[model samples]
Target chain A: MAKTVHPDQRYLLALLNNDAQLINEIYKKCAGKVKSFVCFNNGDANDAEDIFQEALVDVYNQAKYKGLELTCPFEPFLLLVCKRKWLNELKKRAVLPVTKEEDSLLHIGEDTFEQAEQLEKQQEQSKLFLKAFEKLGERCQEIIRWSLKGEAQEKVAEALGVTYGYLRKKKSECMASLMKLVQLNK
Target chain B: MAEDKITWTARFVEGDLSEAEMAEFEAQLQTDAELQQHLENYRQLQQNLRQQLAPDAVREALQQTLGKLNSQYFGHETQVLSLKPIIKWASGIAAVLAIGLFIWAPWRGNLYQQYHVPGQMLVAERGAASETELDKAASFYNDGKYAEAKSILEKLYSKDSQNAQLSYYYAQTLLATGRVEQGRELLTTVYNGESAFKYDAAYAIAMSYLKTGQKTECKSWLQKIAKGTTHYQKATDLIQKL
Candidate 1:
């Protein structure tokens, strides 16, 4: 016999399947809980959204690859996920000496220490990459930033009001310039 | 590797080469030490550029925008409603109008004359239906069906000429579909208008311009949006990214 999928799983699947209204409704229902969790972790509303987004992405990845099986109510499960994400973020920020107030508020999951360490390392690498990115020319900086946002060459060309061929050449030149700058700084 | 190959290496790291060119470039990277170092340096520089350009103010502004969205859609308990009520009310009104037109001719005539007959009614119905269509388009967009959403939004825009919301969303759909010029033109109208979506339109137009690589135009439009109330946060964020 096939295993039965839980309501939370069904709801999440529907959300991941592009039911925006339903997803919006779910957000409405649990946003407060997520916000509270973030606040407890010394994160503001922006941090709350970041945590929510990250949790959603995590859930999406799980649904896509692992076929996640939700064994609890969606509200609690979502809150838990968001809580975990926010706590990890806090740990990375080195908000240090995790206060008893935060500890009391959190669910105190098993993966906390491991995830905290991982997040700290990732944050460190990101900081280094960002430091390296700062040495490029203004134009090169803009091109690379837009490219990272996944803008296409043709679109970038049109935005600059240049020919597609020219834009491609410029992008390469900008990258080369950036490489030179980084090498000089190093 | 030769110095000429080293220069092309920059294009390869930036993903600016065509597929065939990329294949050739990758083949070159396999054996070239100087080219590899150049590529690594380029990657590091790009990362640094992002760090330098990402303003703290932009992040704060995004947080504020998220706060507003939360307040509007999530924080306010009274506003947190199921779609059923709005759907019920719209359908109810539509049904009443339909019934009145068929059965109560005198009442219908009075309303028709007051509202300019079937023309106005048609417009109203079209407006409501267009909103529904736009909602569908948004769903399609979130689902990554940019072409389908663009087609629907375009059809809706054609039906309703003065819908700033539709125009704004249509422009977004166009941008997503890689029709940058058309998207910019459509969004420009909304951005120039004094309508409710003006700020959002301005911000989106700026983003579209940035996507197309018009840094100067994008900055100008972003400035306009940043000065506006409704889209200040988003505009600020885009400005920083640019």
Candidate 2:
């Protein structure tokens, strides 16, 4: 008997299966708790959002690659992940000198220790990508910007007053160009 | 002829050509070396344009736009509903609806759910033999054991006629194992309402068609998924690439 799975397992399974709406519902159910934790740790709504996204990605990756079995409720698991992510973000910001206001905003409780190391590792990849992104061209920058925002070529073309044909060409060209730039810079 | 070819290549790369003109351009490119070179040059020009733009301004503008859109769409109260959460909710609803339909409205609901599951569970007191086998096949498929997986799935499908999961996975397995035609057939069956994995099955079928270089067939199936609710984002993503 494949033992009757827990609710969190079912929720995680739903996420792994790429059922977007169900995942949203679970996120809605737990977002407040996660947000509170983030805010208490001297984070803002933007930080909460970033942490939530990273936590979800982490959970999704764990489920897909490592076959992670959920031993706790979805809320606590997600909250734990997001809490650690926010704390690390604060610590990274700390390495640079900060004003009195900024200094006061950097706080992390001792309980956030367990996942802090993991969050640090995850942040490294994102930081590297951001650094690489800076090396790309203006057009490459715009193309990637619109692309990430789920902008259609037609929309991008209309907004920029270019033809759809030019937009597609530009997008592929920009990606290739960025790849080359990243390579050259490296 | 070369002048005419270059003009067509530019138009095609610029996305100014109609479908018919694009087709003609591709056909001509197959036999015309000059046209191919011109097309490559056009591609390089586009790349150069990208290399000259400013990254920070573009990123800042994009981020601002995304932030505005996110707030507008979700509102502050519902901002908690992130992409991950939305996916989770959709899956849960889909599964509950599937199971509910299976019980309350057996004929219609089961039929609908069946289109998605690929392999229907056996009702034996000891649980279905095919369920365990299909699970094994899934594990194998995930592990990149296409051949071993396909063999098990195929055997189970032979024993169980209407198992959608089996048929769907088998089709995917076939594609992975290099049996494109057979995989296509099974995928078509699932896509055409012969099996349960309707949305995902259709998406897979379209992807398989793409793998076989049948862009037209791939587009058609992709269009179907794009129109449907469940697989819309995936379909949209693929169509954009095409």
Candidate 3:
């Protein structure tokens, strides 16, 4: 499928590129909605602030790791994430009362909800990825991170004083080892 | 079958397969579900790789900016939490403060002495860039003139954010001046990035974590140092203690 860039691609690009003005605009534009959602629930202003920041960080993560193309508008998607996260927080804190925004997100169809779910799922997988990467010997972690970064395999090999073929074989072995670690973690 | 799968999977992912070879691979892919699953995993892995594993600076920057905006917009309640209570208990606070300082000042001094290491200054010798502000900052930094070094280093860092020498030395000055958090932030940037001082910054960052009582993160940073770096031995020793 052809990737469609949203009109508010600027919000995401601002986040990915760390554009200060645009980031401020995101808080100006979207944060109020999140704050309202959190505050209207049992969350205080501090809780609202924390939830909003956590949600934005997840959005940043998705954009950084997955090239997150906003399928729906940004606010709904962001609010969905905030609501889901706040619900999780409440659950973790053993709050038995359902949040007031429980059915507020019912209009966000299966796809948008699925995307939010995917973000949460990706968060778990990313933790696993980092854990597995760290579990490797330092050489493998360095080689895999640098190699995956589109660094020329030959140049990396030369830097390490190994042949290109050896680099490729070693990289593959390291990646396979990482995959095994992730699988075992799963 | 296994050998063919390995070679062909690698070749296909590499886009090194010829037209006929591609045709054969696709034909096999149609019949072989496991091959299909394997390729999907490869695709996910490749996607994971190309997306650049967590630079973190961007996200942190955004969060900092957004936090400021939050204070501006929804910060009415926060301001009301002022020092009124302290004013009410001013005399009591002064007595407590005097007692606290008597006991606390030496402990704070000891902590700084334990963790702070002044960075070695760059001398204008043998092919080094001579008589520059960077050199002045380095000299001041090494001489433990962190106040002068920090002022000069901040000027240099602001003027040329890309200069690794300025950033690295400035980060050290920041650390020396008891600004551990800001110093660690820059050290993190230096170590994660391509810099001559990456290994040094790695060691400094681990030390920062140690000083801050974050032993797990300290161990992780120490573990990332390759064996050839100057800090590798010290890092391992520190890791053992942690």
Query: Per-residue lDDT tens digits of candidate 2, residues A77-130?
Result: 566566656666788768421223222223433333333344445335334444
Can you tell me which runs of candidate 2 are displaced by over 4 Å? A1-186, B1-131, B226-228
Specify the poorest-scoring 10-residue window by lDDT in model 3 chain A. Answer: A97-106
Q: Where in model 1 is the C-alpha error above 4 Å?
A: A1-135, A142-164, A177-186, B4-8, B13-28, B31-242
Best by TM-score: 3
Ranking by TM-score: 3, 1, 2
Tens-place lDDT per residue, model 3, A81-165, is 8788888888877885456644554467555777788888887777667767767875777677666545677888887778877
lDDT of 3 by residue, B1-242 (tens): 33445445655665556688778889999989978987787677666654435244666567667667767766644433346544544654465445434543434544323433444555333232347566677667756799899998886675345556678878888877776756776787788777778988887887777777788888898899999876676567557756
**Residue B101, candidate 2: alpha-carbon lDDT:** 44
Q: Alpha carbon lDDT of residue A131, candidate 1?
A: 51
Model 1 residue B128 lDDT score: 30
DockQ metric for all predictions: 0.14, 0.03, 0.19
Chain B TM-score (each prediction, in order): 0.44, 0.45, 0.50
Per-residue C-alpha lDDT of model 2 across residues B1-242, encoded as one tens digit per residue:
33354455655765656688678788888998877886775554343333222123432333333334334333355423346645554665677557544543434432222222222222112222245556677667756788998898877764443457667778788877776655765676677664447777777777666766677877788788736565676467556656
Question: Order of candidates by DockQ, top first?
Answer: 3, 1, 2
Q: What local distance difference test score does each model get?
A: 0.59, 0.57, 0.70
- Which residue pairs does candidate 3 place in steric collision? none
Q: How high is the lDDT of residue A19 in model 3?
A: 84
For candidate 2, the lDDT comes to 0.57
